[model samples]
Target chain A: MTDRAFAVVRAGALTSVQDRGRPGHAHLGVPRSGALDEPARDLANRLVGNPLGAAVLETTLSGCAVRPRCAVTVAVTGAPCRVTVDGRPAAWGAPVRVAAGAVLDVGSAADGVRSYLAFAGGVACEPVLGSRSTDLLSGLGPAPLTHGTVLPLGPVAGPPVYADAVPWQGPPRELVLRAGPGPRTDWFTARALRTLVTAVYRVSPAGNRIGLRTEGPPLERAVDGELPSEGMVLGAVQVPPDGRPVVFLADHPTTGGYPVIAVVKERDLAAAAQAAPGTPLRFVLTERR
Target chain B: MSTMRVLPAGDRALLVELGSGEEAEAFHAELLRRRARGTLPAVREIVPAARTVLLDGLDDPARFAKGLADWEIPALVSGAGSTVELPVRYDGPDLAAVAELWGVPAGEVGRIHARTPFRVAFCGFAPGFGYLTGLAERYAVPRRSTPRTAVPAGAVALAGAYTGVYPRSSPGGWQLIGSTDAVLWDHARVPAALLTPGTRVRFVPEEG
Candidate 1:
């Protein structure tokens, strides 16, 4: 009998199983922990003919190496990286067949910070709250992959979708995020608001799944006292006492006390995820729709 | 009557600001009522916090914002919801310290806690951990100067106008006063969180 599983050879940096994530449980203090690069994950799954909600591996920075116990179709997307099967070059952004016991290696990203690897059947893991995405903050779902981890793979669903060419967008040299006024915009000083849009910022190395912390001119506050802790939203550009802006991401806390000066449009956050540490960032203020 | 301020949280959600925690709880209850009646559209989450209720993952936030203007805010009594009794054994490491801060006997600490009816203000910090209110203003205590590396699960703890039970073992700073066997969170349960927003709770002291 053919075993349907893959053994992790090299789990580079941080790799974990991710899907669309559990969203409706914010009231239960659960973070919406999903693939940071949603389009990439979706594309990877689509190329492999897997359902959009099928669980896939999300690799950070350095990519991972896996050996399937059974033959499977695989596709790598998100960051442009080297994909190889048994030391032979494989296609990135397109489906490639991997024979059983062949080592499938996804190399370190050339320009982006994260990559998505989708197998034909998808990584089948026990779902917590209807999601396989790992919540780093809450320790929900499967833990980050380690060497020697054997992950089960679901049976192939359908034929892989073959495209003439798959367009891959390279990581931005200067990340441009569209910002709209936040609920607590009044908390910041007028000059600080101007600085937020005018001054150049860099992606802080300290950024994690929780938020995209920025290193730039601090936004001075107009309000003297702390705002009571209130529910926070994704893309909120929250400013702590340090005066720097921290764009809340998928794993952001359900509630926070700091004031939010602006919120980045959700569409632009996919690019923010690929931005490497110290990538130049610019906030473009836009009128609310 | 205080007016509710509907503010944009993001493109997808709105934060409705209320005057107090009680008002936030009341608004959350009203929203839940509207949802149950099918009057409110599908929303991903209705999260009530200190002074606001965040309506997240709305299909159309702009349209919903307009609808919120005409929605009537209902007056509700705090702790009016069904109550869940949690039996706790008061033998935490922070019991003596919490008792010292209140200038009461260690035995009296559990008595005061059990006497008060606590309403779930909001759930945060951890899954199924409810930040409950209803303790007197005098019981408002500061968090420990240094947080413990790891607080055990089922630890009934208190800090800054809120008393909560540790749903699962994790690092926490709240001063522990007791421990309970009642499950605060279970994924297999219909509603994973035992304590949700607007649920009233009672901490019953037990002899261990």
Candidate 2:
């Protein structure tokens, strides 16, 4: 791999490289830690013409500002971040080609909470355990990108430019989600989850890579006894004694003790990942097989 | 009345409940047997818990259900099974604390930890991590009230009915009793994780 540099002009709170994430090791207790906004990440990559699973940047809470070492083309998607290249405004949901040494800045969006940046080729980081995504919870890959960190990019095949949208936009929800039965649904109080799925829940400010705290009707567990620690999965809605359901996300641990009442559908994950604080969500159970 | 039910979880996963822990164990064993014989289709992984099993598979639910219906329950492994010895250094910060809570000698904790071989119960959460069950009764200790922000890799810990080693450094609430140098997960390895369900493990005190 050739060494390159793409300086972070203004690194926001959290900016890290991510790919499709490490999969196929669930038996080993590993979470499939990757891009939080999967669809946005995919769309950005496609716009820049990178492979579907190629590594891209995941900027969380706040946004980021970047400057390529040489002439490079890139795309931005997710969280609707307000973007500008070399002080000239650019649009989200599209790609932009920059001349050599052009500076690109990403600012927080009025709507969502995270943004994805895809290079024409892909963000080339030293892959750890078959993925380039940063597993902050596991400390498995490169640390989050900082202001001075120079990211290396690989060679691209064509000129940088924006592409038209394809036909794959997902469900439209204020807080998008698809639901499924959890591993320990039997532990939940009868109809407790029905209330959860039908009621509107607000995202508590207490949210991070591990899980999202939500405020709604308290979900009661049937068996009061402590559960032996067991395996967990991304999107698992775990209820602790406090009653608020914590939805596990990308950097979740391998196992937990609290009862999990539901799992968010994989396709609905992107919307949840980009949910801003106070966003209200309502889970609609589906007959989808 | 049946106390549990099987439900479709997603496009590629299912949640099967067997009521009690014993029933879950039996069902998991049968599923494992079917998996080994290549009789199960579409299933990518089968994770067993105290009373349920989460089956993740390639995106075909109908085919997976068919495979489940066709599985034949197999006999459990009898007598002494294959055992792999592991060297563990009994110097974790929580070892003495856990021993005192158990009303046992601190040094005796190590001996008890090694007394009986533990079996891999299930795997999930992160890659190459294993949930080991069947710890000796005396060694059982509740998890810490507050989890550590970061538990170093290879740290061996126990909580409730299970004990495990942290595959990578992360936040944890388990009571750490020891550590091991063995690599539980190496991405380059043909099969990354060392422990799979039913694999037996014995911890030998490290000499240093």
Candidate 3:
């Protein structure tokens, strides 16, 4: 195959192509879908010498495996995982060169929830709205990666970075998110804010790409019924009728009716993506955004 | 008109609240005009909803929000947007209920709904699906107490003061009144959604 493609050998539990998500389409009810762990995806891209927003594979919990049609340099980041080339151990966070026809395996996460794998020249799938990201919400772009799926690759962009020591922050023992007020703060009781900060919350197993469901104290509503549908931004701490706050993520609906009590800082959300199920989450209410 | 209130949604987004859906639509139209004319500041997304418009990915959310206070928004141009015609068959199960709600004979339901012009107020619930406004407040209807397990694609429905066509098969609560053959969503097409925010629409009745 002269097409420079990588065939999925072991399709993990959930794997999809992602880059900087297709934005500017929220008005059409399109979610801004992209890499959950932005910094880790960027680091993988940097190691493989691809552009900042080049497409890469985002593997959930159990990682995926791929075999390139041509010699390639690849890097795996995000959740710490066991990576192997042709049944031999390979670097997990650093770039490794693999010859054509060799199986590159990315195993299950040791701590985090998602892992990012970037290949040299990036996955060159036909861009939908100028993104390769698979939006689970709108069902846009490519579908989730499956075994035998062959994805084309773009031409190499730049030289790969082989660093001696790259700063790697391990997955948090307890997730801390700094949150600021949302537009519908008045909908919740005064004690709701206190409960939000003081109450213990864990990342629920029901969480998906759309939002992080939290198992915690249900916030008391000051008002009754739902609001007229309003735009939902990333990190929106929306309190549903059930009263549990669900933190909006990359594939969140463009608009929602549930009242949003607060919005976690965008920087803090990258960590939220890697948070494993049952990980303790703390929402620190801050005066300033 | 009440002053447009700009509330903070997050550090990256600001929500501008309008008095009603009509005002929100008008503001969205004006914002589109400014964005097209290169007058609006650099922002990532402009999402319109029931009574608000959210501006996201702003470099300085505070500054952009402060500008809203100093500006005057123009009203939306009536009958201005691109109009799409849909051939609809009024064969829904709730046709009688809707007719009773309108105090009109079952036969008149199709004629009355087909006559009114519609505009897409905002899009939500799903992609390619638009919340369309056309009927007056008196024509508004409540949603079904028990929503359908699956509302088929191209199903024309009504809720509150809005009418919408289901883009694809999904669970929905709107009262189904008719059906359309026109594809509401086609991702392969240039503009995937047949109906978008601010679009004008007219339904033509299909002969039995």
Candidate 4:
């Protein structure tokens, strides 16, 4: 818990501390920047008995190497990463106890994209804007973890409270987003909403924290018009002047001008969060009944 | 005139467009009032734009088009919001260029900025950032053709008829006129945002 100095001996593609992201700040221009793979992060945290939102290491596919300075229990979940402790093979998705100076190595995932390493306590870095998650677009949290970086773990008492290991996998192939209508629906022509559901849109390479730009038949508005810039939310599907549809993701702008064809359901956001580039996405219309 | 137009934004949020810049302002006021009284719905967040308000909660996004028909629209009050005085240095690189464009002395730009209190018309572009309207007609500056990759935190910038403060370090296209020391957001504090939708904000010259 308290007396811990965790250091990154080697970093792979990406490594950043992420807890649950800061929400309800979009009106202030902040995105709900957090773990893109929410389920994995949550599972990893639970394995180590960390608090519900304890900070975990969100390592991209390449993975990372870490050296802990104290006794700890850690687990890696999300994307399938090869994990090992001091040259001994370690099972992924399960907790492992480590003494001081033990080196934990995480390779890359074969099936999925992101892997989160959670500690028994938690990563205790400076919390910015009410969350430990890093917003690379906003510079809201600490920089990405690099080699030779030493991280401090939060305080934990007594024994670890581990959860029964239940393996889970993110949605594969086309992600189905449940949505509702938006402000500029009039901007679209007939069957616009139907097209969103019926048509299969390919995720564009231009996707990022801001939004997921997709390739589909240009959505025709009933009235081709301009919308005054207005407040936007995560999961908002905005159609730009080019006629292509772009679904606002975790780091969406506070406002936008394009007509919204539909919005993704809140519960389904995690599926979209882990979608890699070029993944196909489909839309479905549903009510809260 | 106040008009309610509700539309769905994706499957996540609800967008309500209220006609009249005046009505948008009033709706912001009413939102704060309801929030204070704790009668607001399970809305996670509500954002007010120039003439629209986005509501996000567990509400059915499909039913949003119908929800606007039932909301009690608030009355607009042009100058009724609380006034917050912000101190600025007015030393941004674009200050002189902006003044020259307006055919006035660079120092006068600060005067024009502080001439009247600005209303928080909306928050967009970035987090906790506010789009404060009510700039003097003469000082309305167009946005830079190409935005800077990184604008410093607390930077007070202007674009066209909108004046705004950058809450965090971000890329921006607005003309930076000055900087402020007030912390617009801090995660450690309760109610992280410094300027809510209805709060008034004013700019004052800060000497450092």
Candidate 5:
């Protein structure tokens, strides 16, 4: 009822409210569903003078459009895109003030698969287990934004902070990851490990928030039987019956029946988030102990 | 031999391997006890499974992995964890099939299952679905060769050496023998899942 809210004008492909996400609940089968690009969300918050962990809008592929009910300061980061205020062009990675009822259009991503938008006051939605992130797997938090959806805004804590520039890391053309040893590495054949690091892979269209399914040479296994469902961790490179490695993402299940060949370093996962389907990928496997 | 080993899961987690599910349950208990007593490092989640326990969100997993070999895990703390009694109806399509597998009368399956106490070895497949272990290895049953497209929620099922109630409708290969009315998971509820690892489960037969 209050005027401190915005109405969705264009919901784009997939847009959801996300924060740092509800972690530490994996034992109860909750996935750590946070913004894939944590740094991008942090930068967007900094420009809008919101807390680093404040909830922001994460838009996939093409961006979104919104009309605020009140005057607000906003910023956009992650995957460079054409941002426009009403009919005029606006800054892409910097703060921009918009009048009440003005349409803020976030156009198709120029280079990345996702873009982040932050308001001076973060999106104030009902938090579930200490997060507002929409978990696609568990169906927690608010549902994905639809056209005409009204989202409440929290009270602004401070004025917008203007910086000289916020560096934008372009989306990865060739997604390279630093992989480490696994808990179930012995499940694979000795030659499998060698094939894993040397094989050329591409991001399959089947990739999602749960995992990045790879299309590559199948890793041969020493053990043919399925694992007795074991606890899985973030960044685990789980190989199914088919042998293609799947890199677990934020929304991955806590346990799986597949054997993990290796684990991708946490630092490199941000680039994986923006990798479009068919992006070439290489694994630089670390020494096995 | 009480075999135990630890493997590093990237930089943030360590997977402790045990010889059996019972050992995993005991080790998970030790980890929880240490966590409560402030002896263990501040890790996010310590998840148990069939024969492995994952220590996640640790700052330095290698340091913890090195110390695991020296620690002696105690036996499971009897009567320490909460026990849940589930009232189930012995009317499922797979009841006859499961009864045949056990070489018992169809009607006797419910009574036999209700008498034994099952402990949750771990939870996986979906939210709130706990893999309960108690039946001896001799009772291990093979999963359905072709999984049903939709196993209704609350279906009490068996596979291998474990029994579980489906928390939600999902495609599963387990042999179903009954159904329960209890809600296994509710996001609005505190703790969300009704069955967590280390809990004791007792199935009670509902009057037909």
Candidate 6:
């Protein structure tokens, strides 16, 4: 093991390396797969004094544990989670030093579905297309972390940023998405549109990096035949044959055949990433800004 | 020069609705030409699909939409663009079923497929996978009733009015007619996808 490498002690349920995803590749049928909670990932990198685009570990509801080959500064952000070093309690949002060969354990998220962890130096995995983000849909970048996996770390850029306090938002009790009318709003009945905005939906447990599937009143379509396959954008609220709206997330497909009634604002997607299953969801349609 | 509708896909993206896939392709090519000339700014991605082209990551989507409304779409000059030829072995499991559907001998399937030239209409389902159009309306077929659990990479398949090659192993419902060894996607290759929208494609069957 190199001095700047870490071995995974426990990989939890699902853990993958992520950064600012590979954009501008939709034309090649590639998805923009990156950290779902962009702000949290950015904050973790900032706390560790790493570049904003540095690759970090994105853990699912259950967190992970790693043992570095060398002492390093680390910060955990996103969902508030229990942090420990060799069974001793450690800081959650602030930078903390971990001795070489010591285990850094991140516990299950307290309230959210995902968490972000950043090292003093970013994960230096070989990038497939200028990014270390693991794309689940297209199978690009590094694979999800498994137990005993070793990851190389980049050179430390600078000392960690010491701060008295770091602002963090808790998981949304109700995921409210501000949406704008879209490419195929005319395909749905007027009552379906009304139901989309007025009805209450809950996040489906089947939701993953691909989309936030919802369970609610099935939307009725005015048109019968399927629309020709069309390009889909992030945050697109696509309604499939099942009629439930599935909001495209970071790892969403580049094209889809379903009608997209609206697109949620990109800013609100971070909260959507944290919204646990069964969380109420409401869509407020607004004029395109 | 049919009238086009530019709808707001989101705050940063504009979806232009063209009447047909050919129109969408022409519009996409025009946008790429304009982008090459440095006229389009803050344009992140131009994704051309069956009947619409989505322009994403623009600084001002509304302003761009206004410009697109006035932009004239050029005629597509077929045979003037790049073409990728793929060599195939006609030994797919569904070849007999597809031949039965067409009421033709199984051996005639490969010849019929290779005779027609295909145009990449759009790409989706997976990376580097292009939905090619060329088959006549009579050849349009429905997807298999049950999807396969694992379709091998490079499997040449057809569904509806489109034919496509599996970029990688994935579950699919398309009727498999052959297999190819050509690399569809490679990160090391420039323009990773072998088939991009507007590119022409030809399939050549290996002689027994």
DockQ metric for all predictions:
0.78, 0.45, 0.86, 0.62, 0.77, 0.86
**lDDT tens digits, residue span A1-289, model 2:** 1235588888888888999887665656666689888888888888887778889988876789988887677888887767888889986777787766778888875467778898887888778768998987766777988878887886674554455664334323468576777766778777787677778888878887778789888887777887665556678888898878888888887667788777887767777877777888787665422
Look at candidate 2 and tell me the lDDT of residue B203.
89
2 or 5, greater by DockQ: 5
Docking class of 4: medium
Mark the regions of model 3 whose C-alpha exceeds 4 Å error after superposition. none
Candidate 5 residue A64 C-alpha distance from true site, Å: 1.8
**lDDT score at residue A274, model 5, on the 0-100 scale:** 91
Give the winner by DockQ: 3 or 5. Answer: 3
Total clashes in model 4, counting residue pairs 3 or more apart in sequence or in different chains:
25
- Please report how far candidate 2 places residue B105 from its true position, in Å: 3.8
| lDDT per residue (tens digit) for residues A1-289 in model 4 | 3368798988878788888888877777677778877788888887887777889998865789899999888888887768899988897888888778989998876655578898888999888777888787666787888889988898763355455656675545777777766556666776776687788887776776567778877777787556778877777788888777887766676777776766676677766656666778887767421
lDDT of 1 at A201: 99
Candidate 6 on A153-242: residue-level lDDT in tens? 999998798889988889999999999997889899999999999999999999999999999999999988978888899999999999
Instruction: Write down the lDDT that model 6 would get.
Output: 0.92
Better structure of 1 and 2 per DockQ: 1
lDDT for each residue of candidate 1 in B122-149, tens digit (9 for 90 to 100): 9888789899998988988888889888
Q: How accurate locally, in lDDT, is each candidate?
A: 0.90, 0.75, 0.92, 0.76, 0.89, 0.92
Q: Could you tell me the lDDT of residue B126 within candidate 5?
A: 80
Ranking by lDDT: 6, 3, 1, 5, 4, 2
**TM-score of each model, paired residue for residue:** 0.97, 0.86, 0.96, 0.86, 0.96, 0.98
Pick the TM-score winner.
6
What value does the lDDT take at residue A59 in candidate 5? 95
Clashing pairs in 6: none
Better of 2 and 3 by lDDT: 3
After superposing candidate 4 on the true structure, give the runs of residues whose Cα lies further than 4 Å from its correct spot.
Answer: A157-165, A191-195, A215-226, A241-243, A286-289, B10-12, B59-74, B77-81, B89-92, B95-108, B136-139, B152-155, B167-169, B178-194, B206-208
Q: List pairs with backbone clashes in candidate 3.
A: none
Chain B fold agreement for model 1, TM-score: 0.94
Candidate 5, B1-208: lDDT as tens digits: 2598888788988988899887889999999989889999989988898899998999998888777768988888677799999999988888899888888899988887888889888887788989998887766789999999999999999999799999989989999989999999888888889999999999988885
Question: How would you encode candidate 2's per-residue C-alpha lDDT over B92-195 as one tens digit per residue?
Answer: 89989988977888988788887766877777655666677777556668879999999999999987767888887878889998999988887667676777
